[model samples]
Target: MAKPIARKTSRGADRMETTLNNKVLTEIWGADQGVGLRVKQAALVVLGIAILAVAAKIKVPMWPVPITMGTFAVLSIGAAYGARLGLVTILGYMIVGAIGFDVFAGSSAEKFGLTYMMGGTGGYLVGYVLATFALGLLARRGWDRSFVWMALAMLIGNVLIYVPGLIWLGQLYGWDQPILQWGLTPFLIGDALKLVLAAVILPAVWSFVGKART
Candidate 1:
């Protein structure tokens, strides 16, 4: 009787491990099961927020909106964390910024807290959340495995960010404000570079992971 129970327990453990391995790559790579998983996930959220803060600070000044690596970080985190955790992580970052942390692109005494969130770049920030969600969904679908598919996924995420951003800019400055020049054109080249880099990096990482697993 004791031996049968032990064999059953072992089988259950094996099943749990199999389930974890079959999940999205990020979850498989970063998470674990049982009692410690929640704590591990919380730590991942904090780390994601920290990464966003650092990326926000690496910017090139431009009119209306400064070009920043924040977008790149957002998409990358999504692709690496899956939908639920990715959304949680991004929302955590936003909440931190909203509560007056100096985590935004150009934090200053004059521009912090909710006031900054409601500024010209506010839409872009919201877009980051949406884009991250989208990318996370794609990542769960295993879109990150191929370079072409990953590129398309990243491109979609990039476009998602601009949509809300442009709309908000239009509303703030009105139709005659040349919103495109200020909000979109300046960042085209930079965004393209980021997109390509992300596309390349994700597929390469997936390849490396495959190699390591084998």
Candidate 2:
């Protein structure tokens, strides 16, 4: 009888731990609330897209590549919204940009739609979606629950953005262009700053959430 009771209690404790570990901030903020949740989620996605658009427009000019707040916004959205919603939000942003909306970084009246997407920055744009998805997966796994893990997750997402961006840039300009000088070296400091900022903000927000819940 004692052995059976002990085993049952252990199982119950394990389940409780799993439940606690799986609770992401998005769900904690009521994303799991049934019918109305869909509407709220849709709203969040739209908001995220808007944020990305705005971030894209804020650029620090550089040769070949410019620094933008877009990466920070992408990581934040992924951490705040979780995997499914983050993926949807990024995809929606890309769709809007592809359709000729002036939402992409440095987008102009002369450049819009699919034509603009296939431009030099196109690979980076696609990378945004992948990075968001990666970050969101980590967020779902509770990596966003603390500072260090969140920072590491965001850093990984940042690197994912660079990989495709560099490849596309290299393809476009060839070896003559010095791809590292154009694509990677210029943005390292900015990306590092963004990573630290995200790492601090997410854990701070989680702290607030914990207080609110209590």
Candidate 3:
């Protein structure tokens, strides 16, 4: 009986290690072989939803405009959770916002829920999912392990976000309207700052984890 139990434990650890081969940052802490993937994902999704809400609501004062952490949170979560889990987490957060949770940066009690979702920010919301997916894919390819690759990945993700976002703005408003000014230009500086921050943070974390292991 003892030998069988030992073998089972070793097998489980082996399975977990195999699964974690292309691990994201979140798996670096609190992951256990005895725990199932579904359980870990469910918990991470919940925590991610909460983090999205808080990041959406908070604003840091900056020179051009107040910096909202919403996009940063979305990208980071995608990089940390990978593609499928990131999709689920972002979708869950969107659903919560759609149901009138005040989970969006521009939403208010007076104008919240699905109506708000269908407004100007609608395209950007769609972009969030696309960008998240792209980031997840890049992170899986080890882009998040180095500052240069991470920065490039972030630039690609931002482009994914802005493309649909600008198109949506054009369709919603008018083609002649200053869609660039309204939706893209003002945000570029802030996005650049965020890109640098993410580039520095993700690689530094990987370095820390590597050192700690040795």
Q: Which candidate, 2 or 3, has the higher TM-score?
A: 3
Worst 10 residues of 3 by lDDT: 29-38
My TM-score estimates for the predictions, one after another, are 0.85, 0.86, 0.87
On lDDT, the stronger of 1 and 3 is 3
lDDT of 1 by residue, 78-190 (tens): 99888899999999999999999999886778899899989888889989999999998898777877788888998899899999999999999897999988788888888
Candidate number with greatest TM-score:
3
Quantify all predictions' global Cα lDDT against the true fold.
0.85, 0.84, 0.88
Candidate 2 residues 53-127, lDDT tens each? 999889876544567888899888888887889999999999999888999877899988899889788888878
lDDT of 1: 0.85
| Candidate 2 collision pairs | 100-113
Candidate 1, residue 71: the lDDT equals 86
> How much does each candidate deviate from the true structure in C-alpha RMSD?
6.0, 4.7, 5.9
